[model samples]
Target: MIIRENSMLSRRHLLSLLAAGTAMGGAAGLTTGVAHAQAAIPDITLGDPSAPVTVVEYASYTCPHCAEFHSDTFKDFKAEYIDTGKVHFIYREVFFDRYGLWAAMIARCAGPENYFGIADLIYAGQGDWARQGDPAAVADSLKRIGLQAGLSQGQVDACLQDAAMAEGLYGWYQENATRDGVRSTPSFLINGDMHSGNMNLSQIGQLVDEASS
Candidate 1:
């Protein structure tokens, strides 16, 4: 899906969107809307921050090809590069729809320490959770993933209902995706050069080696 085509999720409609099965609302006294235009959005990172190569991935949770990369390519990349301190990796969420946004919210709910782990679960179960066929059903599936990732019920509920955080995430995504020229899911910025579509571990390794050189 094209990145620039989607409209921003306005702050005024944020709560209603959540309450209408995008989230488990009734978060007591949650922020009504965006705190400011530049609210702090979480940037989930992996590997050594000072590594020679920086790989930024812009991906949507609902995208099948993205799920394929996670399931097939990411583990090896992480093991050979990220774990070895050869490359620094950052994961940026691209929301193609509210379902994608909701999945990201649940992953972020686990906090940065647990974010990647929850994200892994989300990607791994993308077929089941993303295709549940109704906002509430999909929402419930995401909540289950959050719970599976060790997030408490309270935490999941509060996180899903966080309007301010949601707005910040949407804004952050728009700015980053537009600036980085992302037009599709499973896109990568390898040391600032944009690469689109899925690549095998060997292909990714070649790029990593080139960046290193």
Candidate 2:
């Protein structure tokens, strides 16, 4: 519960992290080996566990820049670094608002198998969903995304209405933000070092290579 100022889910501070940047990588053909990540934690990571470089991302679902990074940068990173087992990438959710929280629940509802796909949809449709500014509508839209991923409305609703899960997620965020000095969205923890702001493909590639070397 060590949120901003040692408070949990400090909404104001968390928004700054989302605004911080719009912001990962592959698994050396071993995605399944590590696919069963720490389900107890609110993290969904992909890549070879023994990758030389570990990249942790702190992002908010509502952040447009986050959407852009996922849309523009992630694919390449995933292909070269992650898929090749050059880096391990972890995605930790940072909730800036209730819309984001609801979205997080929906993504989790889809389960690990469909998490990334659902996340892609959320980021790609950020404008359409967040613009509504109505929690109920946004929640419904998120549920649709889940349904398309083959989830049931009841399942989605269960995750959404489960206030305990939301708190747990927020707690996870607080721990990440505090431990990693995450000042913005898309902040990265590269091998335990904090690097804020979104990085381009080449820049990230070089960093990973350097770390590997």
Candidate 3:
């Protein structure tokens, strides 16, 4: 769970993984009052930045538990908290494998403005895209996802080939995940306290109310 400095996420390891991932095709949450700025983390954020409560989510694109949270709980939470500007959400990626990294690249392909929307597509289609179990098939499916999300093939390819960006993201995830003691997907730092596993909207709403109050 603790991926230290010597872990496979080192730039060299990631590059090698990328090469292997290419043969495979691929693949593949938060809130609160304004979360304090962390310039070092490369996160895609949502809601009002100046909102009173900041909620941070750590998740992987290929994680089933994460998908369930997105499918069952996130809609209500987003409606009640994020849209109303009661919480600011920051999404941090956790790379459990190369497939996850590939998924992340696809989400980032459309750029931050469309990142969450693309992510929703990824999670919603997880059953079809990830169950194929062929790296090449998975990769193709992810590109289709990118296309569905309004990305050109060129944009998707560019995002996938950005080795430097991928390496930087590896380090970014490593540092933040370790610092926050994140050992699993669907983990959250609700106002800076780590909460792991799935949580209902009501549970999350109460936490947000408490943090913002």
Candidate 4:
């Protein structure tokens, strides 16, 4: 999908969707190059924290398939499992390029509360925002979007420039992807088993049922 310059994905939209859990609690710095050899697999989670089944997804912002999953299957999944408190859905960024990483950073800036909302908007507007020629210009546009979501330009800029947080997120992503053998976007770890790419609602629901059972 071609992301055009006129896309509606603003920095705030990216931030709201991408930044989910980074701000909750204290800032934890991830150790670089740490793989399964260096540390145990961290349980990246979302939704009802105490939900019975946990679903973790490793996704890239620029991935079309991931967007499709978000646009198609995720809503039903959320309504059926996540909203019902049967599942905890965690999202992790699996960056394949600098643009993907930048998008991830912007999402992180929005923090957990706004993460999913912004993520929905970003995925919905992927073709427009991801295809822009000038990333900085795109970022500026995203910042304006964030303002609508209640983030100030100063906050957005600071979050975007947070190199330490970005590096730490990158390190976490690299380590998990390497361990999970994720070679594509929209990979999921449902109760510890790895599933690659977007799945239909029925397929994902079966997994949730199995996990609950």
Residue 70's lDDT within candidate 4 is 93
Write out the backbone clash pairs for model 1. Answer: none
lDDT of 2: 0.70
Question: Largest lDDT belongs to which candidate?
Answer: 1
lDDT of the structure predicted as candidate 4: 0.68
TM-score of 2: 0.80
Candidate maximizing TM-score:
1
Rank order (by TM-score, best first)? 1, 3, 2, 4
**Candidate 4 Cα RMSD (Å):** 9.4
Which has the better lDDT: candidate 2, or candidate 4?
2
Clashes of 1: 0
lDDT of each: 0.82, 0.70, 0.77, 0.68
Q: Write the per-residue lDDT of candidate 1 for residues 85-199, one digit (tens) a residue.
A: 9999999998767888889999998679988788889999998989876776787888889889888988887777776777778888888978998888789899999888888
RMSD of 1: 2.8
Question: For each candidate, what TM-score against the reference?
Answer: 0.88, 0.80, 0.84, 0.75
